[model samples]
Structure formats: C-alpha cells, structure tokens
Target: MQNPSPTGISKTVIWLMSIISGLVVANNYYNQPLLGLISKDLNVTESAAGKISVLTQLGYAFGLLMIVPLGDKFLRKKLILIDLILVTLSLLWMTFATELWMLYATSLLIGATSVIPQLFVPITAELSSETQKSANIGLVVSGLLMGILLSRFVGGIVGEMWGWRSMYGIAAALMLLIWFIVYKMLPEIQPNFKGTYFELMNSVIKLAKTQPVLQLSSFRGAMGFGSLCALFTTLVFHIERPPFEAGASVAGSFGLAGAVGALAAAKVGGLQKKMSINRIILYSILILISSWGFSYFAGDTYWGLIVGVILIDLGVQSNHIMNQTNYFLLKTNAVNRLNTVYMVSYFIGGSLGTYLASVAWKYAEWKGVCVVGLSMGLAALLAHILFADKIYKKQLNQ
Candidate 1:
C-alpha cells in the first residue's frame, strides 16, 4: 500500500526527492549568511542588502500561490522538470550579476522557481505507505530543514574563501546536476484536479476560506516561521557587532544549532503514531515562545544564541510537521492546493519577519530584534490558545 501510486517509486527515489528538495530551497537562504558581505561588496547599507532576503521569501510566497497549485492540474514530473530548468537559469543570472538590481531580479526568479521542493512534498503522502506517511514526510522535511541550515554554513565559508558570486556559481552547478538526474529518474504521477486552471485556483481560495483547520494551521505557521526568519536574517548583523565581533562564517555556524533542532523535529514527527497532535501543537508553540527568552541574552554570550536556535527550529518545524500532516488529511485529492494555501501564508510571515527584523536591527540592535521576535511568538501562542480546542474539535467532526 505504501508504494503503489504509479507502482515504480522506491525508497531510493524518495531519498533523491528529499535531496533535490533541499538543494532547490537552498538558493533562498544562501543570502542570509552573506548579507554583510553583500552590503560591503555592493556598496549598500546592511538594511539594503537585507532586502534580498525579504524579496527572496516574497518571491517564494508568490510562487507558492501561483505555481505550486499547478501540480494538481499537470503531470508533476513535467512541472517539476520545467521548474528546475528555470531554477538553473535564475541561479546563473545570480552568478553573473554585477549590478544590485540584477541581484534583486535574479533573487526573485530564483525564489519563484524553487517551488520544486513543494511539489515533491505532496507526492510523498500519496507515494508512501499509510504506516510510513508521517515518517516519510519527516524525512523529506528534514532534508529541507538541513538545506536551510547548511546553505548558511556553506554560503558563509564559500563567500568568505572565494566570493559570494562563487557560492551562487556552485549552487547553479548543483541544480544543473539535479535537473539531469530528475529527468532520468522521476516517474510521472497524474494530477487530481480536472477543472480549468482558473477554477482550480478558485477552489483553492474556497478551501482557504472554508477549512478552519487549515486556517488555524496557516496562521500560527506564519507567526512561527516569521520569528525564525527574523532571527536568521538579523543574526549575521547581531554577531558581527559587540563583544563577539565575529565574521559571517561564525554566524553561519549557528546553523549547527538549527541542525540539532532539525533532528529533534524529525524525532517529534515520529510521535504522530504515539501522541495526540494537539499536544504536539501546543507544546511546540510554547517551545517557540521560550526560545525568544534565550535569544534575549545572546548579546552577552554565544551559548544563548545556540540554545535559542535549537529551540526555535524545534518549535517551528514540529508545528509545521503537525500542520502539514493535518493538511493532507483534509482532502487527498487536493493536497497540493491545500499546501499552496498553507505555505503562501507561511512564507508571507517570513517576509514580514525579515523586513521587520531589519528595521529593528537599525534602531534597537539585538535587543529590539528580541522584542520583535517575542511579539511574533506571543501572537502564535495567543492564536493557538484562543482557538485550538473549538477549531480542532470542529475539524475532527468534519
């Protein structure tokens, strides 16, 4: 029952999808660890360079809204392949960029084309066995989380050693490699939506309006991811100042803490069979708010930052996993569309977080950034506490 969608998919292919998803998403985050370097090289203020991250996330949100739903209307392999070709080209544009506007243009396009990862995620639920569904999603999401973490670490070292452009060049080459492999190995899966493209999208909007579970899921998701986005974007600036006075590479090393958090998130995903999801969701949001308490003291020591990173990722990803699992349970036929709504909301929060954190960094420095984070974190907790019982009960009856 686990492997009979088209009957040819295997664990190896699943692992490949996980890797490809991570690689494609990495293009968005590489700018994080390199923001200071970009500010210097491009002769812009740190706030100005930070726009690159916001634009990238905004592009991703727009792409999720526009392109990811197409997975339900077309053969997913064909759509994913086309996306990769465009992704490769966009990264090349980043590699060759000499002017600031070129970086902005390429960043948006790169974010748009990187929706290939989202396409793979819906297929995992359909392709894996019922017993293994949560774990398989966990596996692929772990890869995505690792990619986000590692791109920073890699981006910093690569940018520091050679140059930021060189980091883009390497990313482009990796995409090209993955494109060829996807062309050769990926199996075709038929789409479920039969309406015209406009109708398909209209139905998505309807789902967004009607599904309270999705609404609750998306709202808190946005808040949690937004807090994380603020933390990561401003972290480079934060560490580069004061007693630490560390470099980009050291700031990027914070991904290691996130990696540990990612591991905990994956472990939490396996608890779906053993624990109540409401418990998971509540605990995760509390964890997210707790991380900010740790982040406040990061000005004094690196240890606080590391622990905070771990807690933040664990909280965000654990809640993300639970929400996504419930999204799949909403309707088997329109998982892609449900995903589109959820993720668009998720990344929009991220874009706002990036922008606000940059503003906070300008005026209040690290302390102000913590206030921004705490504000968002509290919003997530409030939303969950106010509505979780009534809404989740309604979803169960439905």
Candidate 2:
C-alpha cells in the first residue's frame, strides 16, 4: 500500500514564520491610528493627511501586482530580504520628511515593500500538509492580523511618548531585526516557474478570466475587506471627538482590545477543521454587521466603540482566514498570482472605504460611517451566499 502523505512542517518553523511574517505585516497598519498625530506633526489638514492612506494602499496594490509575482519566478527568501531592506530605507526616509509630499512618497515605498507578509503567508500554505493547511494558514495569518490590530496601538503609544517621527525610526529598527531573523531561520525555497517574467505576469492576469473560483473569492474578499475598512476608517475620528474626546494615545489603546480577536483566531485554529468554510464566512459576516449596528451607539460611550471594534476585528480576521485558506488550496503554482488578484481588489475596496468614511464624516458623522459599513457588510454576505456552495465543493475536492 502507498504511505500517507506528510505535512512537512516543524512547530518551530511554523512559529518562526508566523512571528516574522506578523511583524512584517504590521508595516501595513503602522499609519492607521497615528494618522492624526502624523498630520499634526507635518502640518497637514485631516483630508490632506488622508491622502497618505490612499497612496500607501495604492503602492501596496502595485507591489502585490508587480512584485509579488516574483515569488513564483524567484527565490522567496531572497525576495523577502530585499523587500525588507527597501522597507527599512523607506521608514528611515519617513523620519526626515520635511513636507507632506515627502511623507507621502515614503509611505508609498513602505507600503510597496510591506508585501513581505504577503509572500510569507502563501509560502506557508504551499509548504503545509493538506490536512493541516487551514490551521497552518490560520497560524500564519494570525500573525498578520495581530500586526494589523496591534500596530495602531504601538504607533499611537510610540508617537505619544517619543514623537510621530520616532515611531518610524522604531519601525525601521524592527524591520532590520525582522530581516536578520528571516535570513537566519527561513529555509531557502526556489521558484518552480522558469518561464519569462512576462509569461508569469500574463498567466496571473489570465487567472481573473479563466478561474471562476478566483473571481468569486477575490470579489467576496474585496467586499468584506472594503466594508471592514469603511468602519475602521472612521473609528479614529469617532474617538477623537465629542462624547469620547479621547487623545491619540487613548485611541491607540483601543487597538490593544482588537488584538484579542486576532489572537482568538489563532487560538481557535482547530475550528477550521470542524466548521465548513461557508459557515465560517456566513457567521463572520453576520458578526461584522452586528458590530457595525452596535457602533451606531458608540456615541453614547467609549465602551460602545471598544466593544464594536472587538467584534469587527474578530469577524474580519475570521472570515479573511477562511477566504484565504480556500484560495491557497486552489493551485500551488498559482498562489502568488491568485494572491495578487485578490489583494488588488481588496486594496481597491479598502481605498473606497476610506474615501467613503471621510465623506461620511462630513455628512452623518459616525452614523453615516456605520450605515456605509452595514450596507457593505450585507452586500458581502450576499456575494458569499451566491458562491459559497461552489467554493466549498472546489475546496473539498482539492
């Protein structure tokens, strides 16, 4: 009889990948909570400062498209190391920015290089055993989620204590530290594709047209992410005004609470084994909608904001993990390409969310933002229901 397949993972390797990838991914969120302080330091208006978020996300989307595909054609370890170096340089440049434009430029570079986490997660999926793939993806993604949830608070605390610029300096140092660890611990895995770069690029682009699963997953992921982004974009504003009157430091502290949900996704990695991915997606979307509804009451007290953020983070991370797990199972050779498509849509939706949040703030304040979020949440649910059964069957067969 043939022997059962092996998963090829060591606990230490998984832990290291999770930690390294998590810290690197935190680069994406470094600016979220600190936007207010950074704007003040740079003497820019809130709307003007908002452009940094947009540019940074755009840069990331660009990298996910233009650079992440290198993973399928080149050695990921080397690619990640080079990316981290660029990120470190960008952060250092940010420390000395004398004008808003300089900061915006550096922010874009930082975002572009932050694709290291993206590279790491897909590689983890490729290496994991089929039986353990979901849990493994959850473990690695938990790091990414933690980075997102915690970076805001860290940015806030560091900005408050030292200065906004100092936060970048510290993040740069962390990047260097992460670089050293990745170089030391990560095993070298060469690419499978020897095709020309153009061929690989064309192949990835073709995925959008050729793969129904890819199309559906990317759209669902985008709508869910977009809705989540819409709610989070206004959270900074809500905590800063009126009934709350909280400072940036206090707003940052709320990020600490969001980390609870992130860690919970990791802790419940076992659930992926029992719960159908469709059910998880459906449940998570409901939680997000409920959270947005509750956030309408956030004006009553800061605790309302706190509870709402917690639920929102939990729902977003859980659904994201399931969505990603399904995608990674599609075709190993296509991981980077698939990720590029999904992330581009995801970032585009997130940018729209931020813009809508700013517009909402002008018209309906927190309530308007909540309405946008709730509407998007329901749309995401509908999108998922339309395709959940098909996706489930595809993943099961894989």
Candidate 3:
C-alpha cells in the first residue's frame, strides 16, 4: 500500500466517523441493562449473567492487545471492514443464543470485533492537524461515549418491548448498515510500519517501556474506567430491588444523565489549550471521587444515581481524552500501537471492575460496589500524583 499524505479531515467525515464509532461500540454495553432479563430468560443466576459483561470486556481487552496494533501494519479501512463483518455475524449468533454458554460465546466475539472504534480514533488523530487533533479526538470520543450510554437506554426499551434477542437482531442489522457505509465513505490509509506482524506487536512493549507518559496515562485511564465500570455493571441489581423495583428501562434511562458528560467531552478536549494534562487528570479524579460519594448515598433513588452518573462520566471522559492527547504527542509513527497498549489496559481495568462489582454484589451488594469504585478512583489519584513529576523529568531528559 502507498503511503498517503496527511489530508485535512472535514467536519462531515468527523461526524461520520463518530456515528460509526458510536454504533460499533454500542454492542459491548447492550447486555448491561438487560442483565436481569437475560438472567431470567436463560434460567441463570444474576452472578452468572454478570459474566456476560465481564467476558465481553475481557475479550475486548484481548482484542485491543492482539488486533488493534495491526492498523499500523495494514490498511485500516480493510481491517475495519473485516472486523465489522465479524461483529455483525457475532450479533446474529447472539440473536439465536438459547443457552447461557451460547450467549457468553457470542458476547466474547462481539466484544473482540467491536474494537473498530479504537482503530478509528487513531485514524482521526492522524488526519487532523496538531491544532485540531485534540478537538477531533474529543468529538469522536463523545460519540463513542454517547453510544455507551444510549445503548443501555435503547437496549432497555427494546428489550422491554420485544425481547433481549430482538435487540441483538437490531444491532446486527445496524452493524451491517454501518459496514456498508464505512466501506463506501472511508478512504484507505497506508500502513506506517513495514515490520512483520510479530515485530509490530513487539513494538508495543518497547513503546511502553520507553514512554513513561504512555504508562502513566494508561494506568490512570484504566483505574478511572474500572471505577466507572463497577457502578454500571451492578446497577441493575440495585434498581430492581425493594424501593425502586424498577424494570430494565428505568435502570437504562440513567444513561440519559451520563449523556450530559458525553456532551461535555468536546469542551473538555478544548481545555487542552488552557490546562496541563496533569491538572486535568487531577480534576477528573476528584470528580470521580465525588460521584462515588453520590452513588453510595443514592441507594435506590434516581436523583442521586443521576447526579453520580453525570460526574463519573464527565470525569472519565475528560481524563481519557487528555490521556490520549498526551499519547498521540509521543510518536507520529506509532499511534496505533500506542492505542493498543492504552486500550488493552483500559478494557482490562473495565473487566476487573465488572468482576469486582459482581463479587461485591454477591457478598455485600450496593455498598460494596461503591467502596470498590471509590477505592479505584483513589488509586488512580494516588498513581497520578506519585508518577507525574517522575514522568515529567523523564520526558525533559529525553
């Protein structure tokens, strides 16, 4: 493949990327709100059903590690198209999944192939000028965040009215439509790395060892995401109990509150011009701590959960964009590999968070889940403070 010169990314192209990203990433979260329905339908316990979320995230982590780095070695458009086809097929299988194991299998495949958004994010950064890069990433990430939120809301409504299986059917169709659109609209970006596949994968580790900024950013993002995941993964159980006794739709509607945070992502990205990345990270961590406080006290109430969701999403998304902005600045030729390292850690954290939530829900319920989230946030804050100066010194020396 011939290397192409950098072209100015148009607003229309950004919007299209954002939409496709949103649609593709939505597959990972659709099972969140509908855990209850799936549990009942499959005649499985809540604990077992929660594995669907955990396994999906684990698969995504694996995918990020194993597949996303290929973008630097092959044409991204071709890779994305192939991944979408696999995602659509996975969703189709999910629609017919009658056994718990079957759904679990499909969930893993869906999560693995749904990493198209990660590929697109690096491409967006590559296409934009330095002046516009952060803002463009923010816009695309905003769409990705919206998809995470709206998938729950739409999944809840669709699952409530028709059935959980029907939601997968719809998702499969949407993925197919997006596959075609992306095929038609997306231009080919040539590979930047000419190394063998093994060499490209090895470079991920080399970059991680060399780049302290990448290490710190990946750690912080993972911790924050883990905290966020702990809350969303187990929220359904709390909402379905006692005072709330709400259905999936009501639980999923909380995404609306989080949607506010999604809208703020672009603005947060724009803050890069005025704020240092460390400062932004510190503020985001503080907001996450505060959100967990709200979540802890909210119990089964809607208002507290809503407020907490807004704060958590805002904190996570802002911190995430800042981290990516820093990562992109570290290397021009290795954006995709950097993304692979960062996102693999991120989804690993997410998987851990979901697992922690599941265990907490089983042993201690909502209070335990909140404690887990708060601890993760505090850990992120501590890591940032401890490593920020050291990493800065390293960067200066380099």
| Per-model TM values vs. the true structure | 0.97, 0.94, 0.97
- Model 2 residue 170 distance off true place after TM-score fit, in angstroms: 0.5
Query: How displaced is residue 34 in candidate 2, in Å?
Result: 1.6
For model 1 the local lDDT of residue 177 reads: 93
The per-model lDDT (C-alpha) reads 0.88, 0.79, 0.90
lDDT score at residue 33, model 3, on the 0-100 scale: 95
> Model 3 Cα displacement at 207 (Å)?
1.4
Candidate 2's C-alpha runs over 4 A off are 1-6, 267-269, 390-398
| lDDT tens digits by residue: candidate 1, 312-341 | 999999998888887777655788898999
Instruction: Give the per-residue lDDT digits (tens) of candidate 2, residues 109-148.
Output: 8888888878877777777788777787788888777777
Question: Which segments of model 1 are wrong by more than 4 Å?
Answer: 1-9
Pick by lDDT: which candidate is best? Answer: 3
lDDT of 1: 0.88
Pitting candidate 1 against candidate 2, the one with the higher TM-score is 1
Q: How many backbone clashes can be found in candidate 1?
A: 1
Candidate 3 residues 37-141, lDDT tens each? 999998899999999999999989988988999999999899999999999999999999899889889999999999999998998888888888888899898
User: How much does candidate 3 score in TM-score?
Assistant: 0.97
